[model samples]
Target: MSRPPTVWLTRASMLLVLLAIMLVSGPARAHEFRPALLRLTELADASGQGGGRFDLRLVAPALSTAGAIGEGDLTPIVPAHCELGQLRLDCGSQGLIGELGVAGLDRHPVDVIVELRFVDGTQVTAVLGPDQPTMTLDGTSDGTSGGADNDGVFADYVALGIEHILLGPDHLLFVFGLVLLVRAAGRNTRTLLWTVTAFTLAHSITLAAATLELVHVPGPPVEAGIALSILLLARELACGQTDETARDSPLLSVNESTKVSASGREALARAENSWSWRYPWVVAFGFGLLHGFGFAGALSEVGLPQGQIPLALLGFNVGVELGQLGVVALLLVLLAGGRALAGAVGLSEKTARLATRAPIWAMGGLAFAWTLDRVLGFWG
Candidate 1:
C-alpha cells in the first residue's frame, strides 16, 4: 500500500508545529558542554605590596552523572609563595605573579577560561586547554601582559569551534543525515557543495546574531528544535529509501512475470516529489539557522573577548566549517570503501540493500531517542 501525498504532508506539518512549540516554550538550561570559568579578583591589604590577598570563584564542570560538581576535579597550580584557601588565595608579598596552571584536565577534559583582575583595575584573560594546561600570570597592571591578544584569541576560539562541532553529538548527527541523504538521492558533488554552503552561511548568521546579543532565544527550545530537525531528516530518509539495485530492477506490472516489485519506481517518485529530497539545501539552511543559536549558547558560556569579538566569532565559525568538512570527507571515504569491499565479496543484492539501509534505520532510531530526550528536558 502506498502512502498518499497528503499523509506525508500532514506528517511534515505536524513536525513543524512541534518544532514551533518547542521554540516558543520551555525554560532555558545548559544544553551544550561549556568551558569552565575561573575568576580572580585582587583584595587589598594594609601592607600595600600589591595586595597578596585574592578572592577566587571557580565554576568547574560536573564530574559525575549525579550533577555533583567537585572542586577537587581541577587542581590549581600556583606560585610557590601563593596558597589557595577555600575562598581566598594568599600570594604573600609577591602578589600572585607567576605561572598559573590547572591540573586534572585529563580526567575531565574542557577548556578553562581564566579572568584575573589586578588592584589597578587591569584585567587579563586567558584560555587553558588539555593540551596546554599552563599560562603565565605576570600580574602587570598594564592590562596587556598575561592576557591573550588577537592571535591567541583567534587560535583559542578556532580550536573551541572545532572541538564543539566534533564533540557535539546532535550537530554531528544532523550533518551525517545530510551526507547520507545526498548520497541516497544520487546528488552530485556540486549539489552537496551548495547544500553544505547554505547550511554554513545560515548558521553563521545566527551564531553571530545570538552571540552579539542581536537576538535572544531560550536555550532548551533551540536544543529541542535541533533534535526535531534531525528526527525529521531521519524520517524522510526512511520513507524515501530505494533498493541498491533499483536502477537495474525491472519495472513491470503485477500481471507480468517479474521477480522484483515496483518499489524502486515508487521510492524514486516519492523522493523526486518530496521537497527535502529535491532541495536538501533548503532544508539544511532552515534547520541550520536554528542550530546556530545552539552554538551561540555554548559560546556564551565561554564568553568572548570584549576587544576581539569579531575575530573570535570569525575564528570559531571557520573552525566549525573545517571540522564539518573533515567529517564529510571521512564519511565519504568510508562509504566508498564499504561499497568496494561489498562488491569484492560478491554479496547478494538483498544483503547489499540491507547493509545500505542499516545506517538509515540506525539514524532514525537515534534521532527519535534524542527527540524524546530533548522534549522531556523542556520541563526538567
Candidate 2:
C-alpha cells in the first residue's frame, strides 16, 4: 500500500483503541462534601455588653426522613467539648441545629464539639466546620458571609471557568490533538510551551471582554463553529496533507533506477515531519477561545458573589489550569514512552515511521467522532 494509505489505516486502528479505553474506564465522579461550614455569631445586650447568646449555624445537607440519620441514631459522638458521650440532636424542617450555652466571654478562641449520625450507622465528629468569614455583632450588614458586598459574581465566573474546562470533553479532545500533533512533528517542548501560552492569552482576553459585557457573540453560532473547527482539524490530520493540493498530489512517485534504502528514506521522512510542529498550536488557539466562552456561559449560570469574586475566580482558575496540565502531562508521558519503546525495539526505520504515524490517525478519528457528537448536540 502507499504511504498515505498506510497512515490512514494505522490511524483508524488507534482510534478504536482510544474509544475502547474510554468506554472501559467509565465516567468520572466528584467526591462528597466532608466538612460543612460553621458560623459563630456573638450576641450583644441593649447596654452594649456581650450577651451569652451564642448562635451556632450548623451547615448540613437536608435529608429525607426515609434516608439514614446520623449512624442510624439521632445522637452524635462528642469528643472534647462535651464529655465522651453522645449529644441529643434536633431535626428541624430545614436541617438539624444545636445551640450550646456560652458561659465565657474572655476566651479569645472557643472550642466546640460537633457530630452527626446517619441512619446507615455512620458517625462523624469535627472540631470545626469549614471556615466562614467573621460577622459583627451589630445588626448592620457587614462585608463578610455572603452579603451584598461580596464579590460573588466574579468568583463564580472563575470557578465556572475552571470546572467547565476540566469536565469538558471537546476541550480535552482538542488538547489531545495538540499533544499528538506536537509529538508527531518532533517539536514537543517548544511547541507545547508556546501553544499553552497562546491559548491562555487568547481565552483570557475573550473571557474578560465577554464577562464584563464589553463584547458579545451569539451562543449557538459559537458552539457550532467550535464543533466545526474540531472536524476540520481532524480531517487535516487524517488527510496527512498540508493543503488540498498536497492531499490531491500523487501518493507516491515510482522510480526503479534509484531505490532509496529504507533506513535513509526513513531518516529523511522523519526530518520532514518536524515541519508541522506548530500546526497543532494554531488549531488549539482557535478552538480554545471558543471553549473559554463556553466556560463563561457556565459561570453565568452559577452566579458569583460580588464581594468574594476575586477569591472565587482565583480558586476556579487554579482548578482549571491544574486539570489542563494534568491532561498534557499524561499525554506527554504516554507518547514519549511509546516513541522510546519503538526505538528500543530495534524496528527498522521504515517500520518505526509507519508505527508512529498510526497514533496521528487514531487521534484524528477520535476528534472526528467527538466533533460529530458535539455538532449534533448543537443542532438538536
Give me the candidate number with maximum lDDT: 1
lDDT of 2 by residue, 215-265 (tens): 887665555565556556555444443211111111211233544555545
Which stretch of 10 consecutive residues in model 1 shows the poorest summed lDDT?
247-256
Model 1 misplaced stretches (Cα beyond 4 Å):
1-32, 41-55, 63-69, 83-93, 117-123, 139-147, 244-261
Which residue pairs show backbone clashes in model 1? Answer: none
Q: Which candidate is the best by TM-score?
A: 1
Q: How many angstroms is residue 12 displaced in model 1 relative to the true structure, after the best TM-score fit?
A: 31
Local accuracy of candidate 1 as per-residue lDDT tens digits, 136-238: 7675553435446667778877887887788787788888889887876678778877887788888999999998899999988888788788889988887
Worst 10 residues of 2 by lDDT: 243-252
Off by over 4 Å in 2: 1-164, 239-283, 348-351
Quote the lDDT for 242 in model 2: 25
Residue 350 lDDT (model 2): 41
lDDT value, candidate 1, whole model: 0.73
